[model samples]
Target: MTDASLPARFERPSALAFLGYAAAIVIILWSFTGAGFSIDKVVSSPPRFADFLDRAFPPNLEPQVLARLGWKMLETLQIALAGAVIGITLSVPVALLAARGLIAPTWINQIVRTALGFIRAVPDIAWALVFVVAVGLGPFAGMLAIAIDTIGFCGRFFADDMEAADKGSSESLTATGARKLDVVACATIPAAMPAFISTSLFATEKAVRSSTILGLVGAGGIGIELKVGFDLFDYPTAMTVILMIAVVVISIEYLSGWARTKIIGVVR
Candidate 1:
């Protein structure tokens, strides 16, 4: 085609493009407000961090210490697992309600999403504090706190996944004169199963980490043990606890990966 006959392309600068860049810079600066985030501060902190790291190495691996730490870590894992299971189970109905395609009423979806957002806004530590106050300190409080937090997170993600599913399957189920519950069970649930499982696993992994923190507030787990170690200025023991958490987290990540593959079938 001749140059003169070619379609003309717009040369105008995009207003939205400039605005987006400006907004990103503003956000980056705003995020650093209280950090004293200069290059000098960054350069100075490394040596201090290195000293701390040097102190953390050559971890204490005494058999007795390992035994106690292991028990506490197991307790934390149990609390996490229980919390995740309960949370994921409860999230299903709430997620369905929040899914727009599944629920025709805009107000209902809005209400459900708003509730989930509110739950998510408060951190698990805060929930742990509240539960600890009401329940008077235990793994029970930790479990409940994690469960509540997971419900918010998993429910929101699950709803989004469900809403994004193919509409044809759902419509087909409805056309078969199936009940709403039946259609959901057959169409929506199956379609979203892989995502739901993945979300649940992610929530479980997070709950495990959060459960450890909950113990700091007297909610019961390795966190309490960690606090004790810190209070006594036993950096070796604290490091051991931290290492245990790292191992557990890594193990859970592997297991979740395996489970995901099993559920979704091997991706080509």
Candidate 2:
């Protein structure tokens, strides 16, 4: 075959690409340095981990233990619900402001986006720690933490969905001399409702899991019990608690999926 007609063979990566790969590798190695992630350490830890696993195998299913776990699980769900409610309610205004086509004044949109970014920068656990200090421990702190975290994520996602909605309906509403709020309420919200519901459900599922961890810092939930079990070296109790959490999370996921189908209608 003619050289021009032949497919290229063994094309070399560019110098910049090679340098980028080297830099990435260096950064990864540097990160591990502080992490104390030697192969020897990893190998040595397996025996300790195996011993823990042996202890955890027979899960404690005592009635008192189960009852306490059930109550804590309910508290975790309550925290998640409260956070989801507050976060979704508070997100509406911010999301509306952040929607480009919905809201005017470029500076206002910039400010809203910046604030959302700032809120999203912190992890939920960090927020939980802060609120635990402020509120003096309990599900209140967990609720607040999840609310703040969800506001940042859900509001941004909702705003993006809103901006992508069909402008024709909103324009028609405006032509009829509908006020801005009326236009949004009548036109924009319906178009975005399915997406909004889906996002809220997903956020709620995440919040439920996060609420469990918030208890590590004194925010009330199953995490406190899990921490106690761990502290007391009661691996079986800890394993039971972990399994219960897994069950709850899986149940929530299944319910959310069903609800999403109902909200969005059956997908073909």
Candidate 3:
């Protein structure tokens, strides 16, 4: 082959790229130090973990224990379902308002987007504590926490989907003397509905996972039962509770994955 026809030698990344990588490493190390990371503590972790395992052996397989765990798991799943429904219902309109391409008013879109941000800022666990204070414990608090988080989680994505919708359809409808609401209903919403449904399904799965931990704040679910086991130093029971939760979570995850595939033709 002629020298001119030879492929150019593959070049290494520039020094600037290496410098950027070095800077990122430095920042990560600095943050790790500030957070008090320690190799010595990590090295000593396995024995403590082993002791935990020793205590957690011989899982609690009693009928009453199994029944209680089953009931709590059911409660958690119900809370997640209810929260997802409530959140998706509430998010749809807000998501529409936040879609800048659909809503021409810049101020309104910005405000809606900002509100979604604020809603998503607080974690579900924190929201659970807040609701626990407001509602005085039980599944209701967890439901509300999950609902609020779902609104944030699904709304932002739904808004983006709405915004990403083809403008030509919306414009064509509007040109035919269609009102703004009609235009969105006929053009944007239908286009985005599948994506919205898929997002809601994912959000429901996320809520199911969050529901497990809400019991930490006495909001309700299997977490409270697990807490009691740990508090009593009943590691066998705790392990049983953990396994029960794992089974339920995995089962629901599989079910949701299958549903998503059927409905949206996507696994995730």
Clash count per candidate: 0, 0, 0
Candidate 1 accuracy as TM-score: 0.89
Q: 247 in model 3: Cα distance from truth in Å?
A: 1.2
lDDT of each: 0.87, 0.90, 0.90
Q: Which pairs of residues collide in model 1?
A: none
Sum up the clashes in candidate 2: 0
lDDT of 2 by residue, 65-162 (tens): 99989999999999999998899899988899988867557788888998999999999999999998898889999999999999998889899889
Q: How many angstroms is residue 189 displaced in model 1 relative to the true structure, after the best TM-score fit?
A: 1.2
Candidate 2 yields a Cα-based lDDT of 0.90
Model 1: runs farther than 4 Å from truth?
1-20, 266-268
| Per-model TM values vs. the true structure | 0.89, 0.91, 0.92
**TM-score pick, better of 1 and 2:** 2
lDDT of 2 at 71: 97
Error of 3 at 138 (Å): 1.4
**103-188, model 1: which lDDT tens digit per residue?**
54789999999999999999999999999988888999999998999999999999998988777898999999998888888998
Q: How accurate is candidate 1 locally (lDDT)?
A: 0.87
Worst 10 residues of 1 by lDDT: 4-13
